[model samples]
Target: MCVSCAWGKPAKPHPLEFCENGAKATSWEVTNRRADRAFFAAHTLTELETWPDHDLEEQGRLTHPMRWDAETDKYVPVNWQDAFEEIGRELRAMPPEKVDFYTSGRASLETAYMYQLFARIFGSNHLPDSSNMCHESTSVALPESIGASIGTAILSDFQNCDCIFYLAQNVGTSSPRMLHDLQDAVSRGVKIVTFNPLHEPGLQHFVNPQMPGQMLTGKDTPISSEYYQVKNGGDIAALFGVCKALIEADDALKASGTSKVAGTDAIPDDPSDAGTVAFAAAMAAADKKHVLDHDFIRQHTAGFEEFAAAARKYDWAELERVSGLTRAQMQQAASTYANSNAVLMVYGMGLTQHVMGVQNVHMVVNLALLRGNIGKPGANICAVRGHSNVQGQRTVGITEKPGLVPLDKLATLYQFQPPEWIGHTTVETCKAILQGEARAFVSLGGNFLRAIPETVAMENAWRNLRLTVQIATKLNRSHVIHGEIAYVLPCLGRIEIDEQATGPQAVSVESSVAHFHGSRGRAKPASPELLSEPAIIAGMARATLTKGVVPWDRWVDDYSTIRDAIEQTYPETFKDFNKRMFHPGGIPRPLPARERKWVTRNGKANFITPDRLFPEFSLGAQSDDVLHLATLRSNDQFNTTIYGFSDRYRGVEGTRRVVFVNTADIARLGFSNGEAVDLVTAIDPETERRVSGFTIMAYDLPEGCCCAYYPEANPLFPLDHHDTKAKTPSYKLLPVRLVRSGVAPAH
Candidate 1:
């Protein structure tokens, strides 16, 4: 419901509050097709493996619990008791450290909480999740910059913000509902500036579906005030350019004696505020009077001296060159930001899916800090999330790495000794499995095979596992690639009724804004055999642990018991969980940055300046034909879930195998608009990681930059290519070159 879910909490929700994609997602889940025992009996493993991703899932909900029969090469129905028993036996046989537990954003808060608790109690910390593949950089960077990993602003901030810098974020395609907010902002005179390698149509113009006047008139709302097609892997440089512009503007104002604190003589002789006076004096004495929030920085932040010094080193020419934009364009964007009273910056995977993803976010924080935009009304950083409850999943402990609260706290709360060792992330897990260092893998939900980069490598590695289990609502590519003895356990969809032992139950999910709301299914169960994720988890825990303090039966039947335990475990944040969860709107978790409170190591927000400002853009001593490739999602898709083959918004019809290339690049490479080419990895000559027969279409993109849909182009990326700090794969930035299918080389 976009209307009810909008920033301002309306007293009454609008009758029509959902979006087109929302309807599609619901229909996709509530499909009539059923994957019953007959379905499995009719299809063999080899036959099903060749089906398209959507086609396999369209076969419908998995009706019965099944186990892989290696000899017969088909999945046979198994009772829930036998499935749980065998899984538990295998889990207990292996060293807990050798097994990894994975989760998806689709799981509810209760499921994620119980799943993590089960993993820790079973003596393994290897809890990798879908967050590691997307938005992990947001989690890693924001915590180091601010006190928390989550964004600082609520959705209401959009109403009052004067200007918004949309960096590498396409609100129209990824999250279409967000377009309403952008439209409202535009209508209210809010200036929106966009920076990306492609000029996204959603950011350019959008027609509101709920508004009839414009729909009939065929007029659309203009979204972006200015759009800059920044080169791929140039976000750091573009952000640096903005910071540099502001610094130089302040320097110019100081030289002209037009700044508020231009000289020491202008300062009042208020002895009580000597620090402010001294700051002015120091600025007057320095080569450039740094026009920063001196009082706020001195009182609430650390490392400004180092950050400012590093920022001053980059001049306009260097930044412009690196960012692939002219000096005037950067200056205009900076001027808009500097002139605005309050500015909100929203960014997406375009800025994050890079080798330097962490640094890119740090630069965004640096830009926000330059004008003191954080911790104020209508001013903050908004890292747009991909899925519902991704943030909640992390909050409830679905992390491969945990440092906020110690294991002792969890141990004391749950009355068990939790594992102390760090777990493997999605990238590390792939490597560990490939090297035979890890044996078992259990996934709560997610299409692991398609969601991860280096698809071939991940699939090849996962095939060597002793056991692999998937708890899902629909069949995905992960179900096809399995271990020697694999298991497919069907689970209830989010939109299906869940009749627990206590009563009809409801699960909660957290939105991108950090508000937790109850989501109860309205539709009937797709199949009678489907089990709730929490119930399945409880069954597994009971079968595995000979004895434990936690009551699994009670927790599964009555979800309120799970909430009570959650409240006790996260007392400070989840205080009175049951009372607040049932409120008109669910409770919001504590955000330290919102109140200008820094809970970081030094009790202050840190202005981190990396040793280097830019990441390596070269293909590492490879052929010169390499171009930067950015993997994108179709308009009709959400993450790895494809609703239809047509991307109506992009005018891409009936195909997802097209490569978008800049017109200049196409001509320079002696290729036409509709030429067929083979996309190959430029980094490793030894490996033939090629996607053949991809049609190249001319697009509005920067030179040396191309675009294609992900999972299809994932083969071009090496498994190890990821952010050093975040361990998120560099899906958006890959070194690639196109080889003509039938013609000779142009160079």
Candidate 2:
């Protein structure tokens, strides 16, 4: 029986809630597992490193504070004061710019806010967060395209939508709660079109494990109205194809001298001709409507005209060729959307994890604006985030490159001159480490070593650090890979209540739709030894800083004071932050686009021309035999962490080492299903890096495209293979080749 079953009746009393993954999170936290000093004493760091990620975590959660002993090569137990003093000494001794402070979504708003405050007070803006890896493209592209980085729609909007166009995002595994919304929408006659490379179970049928009747009968709810297995990196082309088809249809109508279709009375009599004219008109309107603060853009942004010009040139054939989507299919998508009362375009890492990811987001926004889908009810762009509070972290100053406004606000709030120098992004931080420019790294949360791309290089860079501090809940690959002086500080998990010196603290979290709500943990702490992240950060700040720049103790003692600080700092949106959080659903920040008020200088949204018609990938002069490989997550996994070996949705069982390849490509490459091959990537002419050996599986994937699990295939990705604007790794694009060994090719 599962842990939930053991409790007779589950404690969760909320209606319209709970999925398998949610249950897993709850159970994992409530489990009778503990990893303390004795466990570390029993096992050496080398021995622990040899264990599988799951086994090590399953051993029990880390329950005590640990400090790395260089000679012993193991994390030994240390008191809280000792750990803080040591870390404080190292951090205070180093130059502020030489230290990199990183944050993960797992950190609470109180913790995240304190972390940023500490870093700013220390006079360094070196805060590189997990957002850089995931949705930086959304952050980079959406604001320029629609005058906002977040979606204009709320969860309730899905209920009234006529159509939902889901691109690249897997609803079931990524955000299971979205499945409930999708199901409800489908039941209400909403058309859902899913475009992905693999046929995900969430897009097919999802059986609510929590529904007793459904669980007992093994019944499943139908999901997608239409599923399109689009080729990888083909979303932009697919979008353009849809737009072109709409344009062509409009052109044909105009040529025939038909104002409207005989059967369709919905279209206006003077409906403008489609094709280039309609696209151009839409682009023009958006540009006139959306403009960034011109001063900020001129001062902060580079390459504006180049991007605008690229948007002006749109060719259907070229788009079709690039996207691998049929013009007819595109037309269908566009027509369906245009005819629909309301449409929502939802996406995830699939669209953003590419070389042209930023451009891809721009295209998606262009489509939304063409039909005036944004800022209205039941219509918007939904970037289904991977983690719960990832979006919130960014909103509260977790960025490395915080604009002048945020920095200035901090200075006024604390009476200290914050650093004006631009901080390092994730990729830059790695480069800094490799170049020995950065001396120390402090991670609020997250398995940095495993989550980052080019794991081998990242590990080496991590080792070069003088001091590394990880505030985490459990033991992961990151804890094992240590700097010269390392500390593993166990922090309170989300499931555990964070009672500070004052009272039970509630931290704010930003949901996917940009709604901010307070998340108060209901469960007891895993251990009394575990300290809240905010408390730990405050303790470090108190011990490290020579001068008290801000009232760190007040904020740490009571989280409400932190809210007060955030409200004062970002008064524009976070007004009455403390009072509003008490609302049942919480309040949403004022998105200027929601009211069609673009924050741009012209007070209008702008159309940015793409730099290139199509993204180009050259993995060291690709050989004829080489194939481009894309790294992806299995259904059973979330980001870099794997829950199990089986990928139930993809039909892979008991394995994480298998690679999916198109049958035609496998045949052409003289390979067969189950054939083991060495996957080599051309990082450079002199260095041919081997990613990993995998047994090939002939899957119904697009020809010229292949995919394998991430981190495992991360070795194939060079450090430099990333989006130019977002600095996100091109995990969806890689140039590689297969080499057969020992056995003959399948007959």
Candidate 3:
């Protein structure tokens, strides 16, 4: 495994252990072009729909199992047992709740527990993945705050956290080995902060090519000791202005008192009451024990007096007019988080692609539960998990909105019949194939109609389905946007070499801090006609599961027989799962809020509140010619894999269409330095949604916000918007307007 930078592991191994987009994601999976079957018999679904998704994934890898012949509209080749017997005869002719499935955090946790155990034994708990498009609001707001949606610090608690925060994340173009753990948490003095409305440069200043006097003085280091910008759905009004300035500095250091005093027989409260005796002698010479941990919020949390009466119902001039940030930058970020005793925070997908992303993760867990900051040493909250095994494919049961995987202990350890309703997400599988009630989609690796959000109404509700498939290894553009029968297949990539038939196996992933381990594969395969995402989900669960209690051909030939049925179905989080994944730096699973133990439903640690602390969706309420937008992701791309059209850390270069905005909102929206444009959205007087040329560019954002890039603005989003309790897809805000339309390039 070359890159496990999804939090902690390299205690020692370093021979270019990965980064620079993990060596451009392993040189875009050992590239040397392949697509074969005569490159889909000389490309044609109207010339691979005019290419460009990095030229149809650099026209490489795919190799076989094709299908979509729709009167030879093209994707020819077929085999792999007649594409799993015509996707199991068009998914047993519909109604496994009409087939949805769709994973892709680049598979392999034994192929996402054998693709959610062949979509709940070929029945259907729709099982969506890519964590329902980025941490489904920290998996439904950190299990109602601190119970567990992962991340209670641990990467050696960002090296003793003294204060971190970095909200609405960017970590220098999404996880550049978390800038060597923010350069050892800012060389041990910590403090960071950030917030984000743009101005990102790896949260400003990094360099560290593993230091060596910063490559002989190229210097760098800094990383955000404060930033702020905010405002694109202003993270629950900049985290309720740092929890109303840390509850007004813990009620002004408990109403002013001791100025000097050794055995204080009083006398301090009156130098003519000098500003409440210099705010209680600067909170008694800072010995008030760093403001508020109050014995970890009186022994492991709960709704502190209704989240401190909704944090004294927000004031500081409506938290500086909805977090544009002022009141002395939220009192110097509440005096660097009440003089830090350990903070952490961290966020991303700009606090989960908003519509009040689970009330901006319940106001970032009501300012880390007002100082208890979840569990012990170096406080918590992390979130920054973008893609790499996307939280290990929702820790092995993939999911489609259910609560922490139990399914009656996976139907009594994989016997079957579980599906008790709740499924289809990824915008309810495009509103169940545009309300014709879904019709077979499958996926097992992503690009779900180009990382979702309206992309032409999810490719016209997946072209009114009736079977899609994908399984993927390269060729994207959702394999030439098909349906009414499509296929694709391919597979084996985590650096190739798979083999099967019970011998050289390996697989098992987990990482982004739930740990687990083992990944194995050492190059070679790009094609030996692919196959090995758990043997194409055990050859489509032994040809559409007759459910012979899952041996799926001896767990795709020895993946430790699928880690012994994932320790008999998540036995208290994979206990002894193949001998704790051969130890040496592996087994983390347990969590119980990292041992404070609130596993939710009111066991403890909650404080959620926020029905509205501010930012109840605001882009021009109806239309000041809209704007908001957001979208982003481009340091030469990763999700939706573009790899290069240059972002070169936001100075951009060459191009990826453009936008960025706010040099006084481009001189009050008239626009100039590089114009062109278009965008749109509308959704009324007979619908809209545009997206033309783009350009714009100004910079250093945050004025009714802007930005672009996604699956190129995922077609101005509207697929029934999103986030009513984390259904996700608000794709970082999106309202739109733009217009102009021509003239920019040149010099």
lDDT of each: 0.80, 0.73, 0.74
Model 3, 260-296: lDDT tens per residue?
2121122222234333334334555877633556556
- Rank the candidate models, highest TM-score first: 1, 2, 3
TM-score of each: 0.93, 0.89, 0.37
- Candidate 2 lowest-lDDT run of ten: 1-10
Q: Candidate 3 — what's its lDDT?
A: 0.74
Which model, 2 or 3, shows the larger TM-score? 2
TM-score (C-alpha) between model 1 and the true structure: 0.93
Worst 10 residues of 3 by lDDT: 258-267
**Backbone clashes in each candidate structure, one number apiece?**
2, 14, 1
Give the Å shift of residue 241 in candidate 3.
Answer: 2.1
**Model 1, 499: alpha-carbon shift in Å?**
0.8
Among these predicted structures, which one has the highest lDDT? 1
